[model samples]
Target: MSRRRPTVSTSPSWTVGDLTVHRVDEIPLPPATGAWLLPAATPDVVTGHDWLHPHFADAQGVLRLDSHSFAFVLDGLRVVVDTGIGNGKERANPAWHDLDTDYLGRLTSAGFPPDSVDLVILTHLHADHVGWNTRHENGRWVPTFPRARYVTSRTEREFWAGYAMDEARAQMFRDSVLPVEEAGLLDLVDTPADGATILPGLRLLPTPGHTPGHVAVELTSRGETAVITGDCVHHPVQFAAPAVGACVDIDPVRSEASRRALLGTLADTDTLVLGTHFAPPTAGRVVRHEGAYRLAPVPPVAPVAPAPVAP
Candidate 1:
């Protein structure tokens, strides 16, 4: 008699051939003010991008900026991108301070355990992106993915060496990044100029601006492609006005240029896009509309379950 294996499911997923991408969102935060999250997110400004309603915003026009983590499983390897602001992290922002989201549990329920994750990618070293790299253990931060090799850009660490001040950054380095390094699990690589293919189908797409070494993770399987947009462009509002950057971007000017260039490059292509901080229905494609770019979300893909691994 054959034994049945235990199973895990992460719906809201998209697959191409052998690769599967699942959205494990962390929080559904209230809409941040335009002056802070994005000065251009003002009522009048967001009003211009009328497409934002129903999905990206509420009836009152408040833009939603949720933090999410995507699980990429292929060929028996589990790779998680952009760990969201993790549980019990002490952040500078009131909203992020001491979070308790069921992020890790959600990841576990989705089929990939922290120990089972083979690779963890940090597109940049922001507090939100790197927070879950470690978790609180024995009154000290410890690597969450105990058996995974954490990957990040060498340039990003160099920048943090000089800029690791302020309450937020200092805290992140102390809690999230340092612990991972202490465990000897952090692997630094060059910021790929055009997505140096790290894995068989995964590449690092250099799209800096929000941070000095910000890069998107590009996945290609059987000739189809999808790029995770890190923090290069925060809100879809940037789709219509790429120049309107967030208050948190270290170099807003350079970030805008990077966003515009990326949008232009991906406009009307077959490549799917997954925004690091986009609201639900996060996967989309960039298209030119009325001389401006907009995201046309890939019609939602139903969740599918595969055979479970022997525990």
Candidate 2:
């Protein structure tokens, strides 16, 4: 299947009390990405859940995933949840190799420019999630958010540090992860069983399995709450079948356990769930459905248009 062009406006935002969470636009992954990423989500399995059609998946059951980042401001600190694939990066996957997109422009348009960012919360050190950590400049990869502190779990950083990496992963670290580290911008936090409160209302929930030290971000304010799922729950179809695991999951059994646990808490709640890779109408409320779970779609509030000025 061919790639679908972005149909939505530049920056779509959702409200969680006083905070306005923005979804900056990036390139949408090809339809084939679903099959390769989540082989467990076969056509038959996807079609079984009629609710997924026309939004999360095509009528033919091809899963729709995107590459974008979530941005918001908390307590005077400008935050970027994850950085999608960056421009001019080499990778083994053809879909993510040496491509270009106006990701930074979208971020700037959303009111969270690179230089103004104070914190970058990375759920893991995956290539796509960390791609925009650096940008090609003057024949060198430099930290995009020079002023921000890039954060990830200590376990995550330590795991990769001790492991033998392939050419592709090593290359990703060299360009995207290393530049930030060398600039003294990367910070590794210890995520405990009960999770860690990074700020007044922001917390890091340990939902490892996709990676040993992977985490899901939780934001609470004025009694309202939301969770930003990294890769733990890639598509809403996983809500129906939490057992279905991704192909790249470092630990499949543990991954499903984490998904099931996370979904159990989220089921039948008012808490908003923001998917890291979900397509348009990305955020939603989770509710019990046929003994499982499903996302009751919550479309983002349209960005207010600027007032017209007299010529």
Candidate 3:
């Protein structure tokens, strides 16, 4: 059976008091190459194999380009949640090498200026999550958002700072991470395991296992809340098989536990979930159906057209 490409849509400007949420569109991964690796030691979550067909062909698979970075506008602060794969980096994976992302323009177009971004929250220290941390300058790595203070978990920072020197992961730290540290912009945050309020409406929650110190950001205002799941639950398949863990997960068993607990909490709540790699319309709510969990895609908001003048 052939699979249809997912359609894209944008939600109306959602406001939580003074904070506004906007989704930036990035390139989409080709179908045939998107579904390469299954969770290392876990059962296939997106069963039927139909859902996996598009991303693979003749043993070759592709990860979809639905990769995204989110922007949150709060009280006098433009906070960029995560920076997508950036340009001019030496990546071990050829697919991510020397990539150019129009993230700056996407931010500006969405009403937040790149330079105006006051804080950058890195959910983890992975290559894709921290790619835009810096830019090349004078043959050196420099802070990409000159005015923003880059934030990461203390454990995550320490782990990568040492692990980055290793052959396989060193390039990740060199071109994508260390540059921000060298620029005095990196802020190591020590957040509680359950969750903690970062700002008035923004909170941080530890959902580790994918990485030891990984976290998910939650924004709430006047009862309206949304969570940036980061990489805790990468693909929609996990919604059905919460036990399945990504191959790269540092602790698959622990990660599965975290995913299950987190999903359970939001299962019946009003929280809108924002996943970094969940195709398009990256924002949605978790609903219980057929005695199993499912991801219900949020409908896109219709664009407001200009008013008609006297004809």
Each model's RMSD to truth, in Å?
1.8, 6.2, 8.0
Model 1 misplacement above 4 A:
1-10, 33-35
Give the C-alpha lDDT of model 2: 0.90
Model 1 lDDT tens row, 191-253: 657666678888897877788888888888998888888999888878988888988888888
lDDT-sorted candidate list, best first: 2, 1, 3
Per-residue CA lDDT of candidate 3, range 1-311, in tens?
99543232232344444456776655554453234433331234343334333331122323343656887666667788888777787887666678877766665666555667788999998877888788788998778889889887888777765663666478778777777887788888887876767678888788889998899999987788889898898866677667757768888888888898889889977788887776655667887755647777674445322111111
Q: How many pairs collide in each candidate, listed in order?
A: 1, 0, 9
**Model 3 segments beyond 4 Å from truth?**
1-18, 30-34, 40-65, 302-311
Model 2 Cα lDDT, one tens digit per residue, 1-311: 99543334358888898788999877999999999999989999999999998899998899999998998888878899989889999999999999889899888777777888889999999988999999999999999999899999999999999989999999999999999999999999999999988899899999999999999999988999999999999999999989889999999999999999999998888999999999988999999999899999899897743211112
User: What overall lDDT goes with each candidate model?
Assistant: 0.82, 0.90, 0.70
Model 1 lDDT, full chain set = 0.82
Worst 10 residues of 2 by lDDT: 302-311
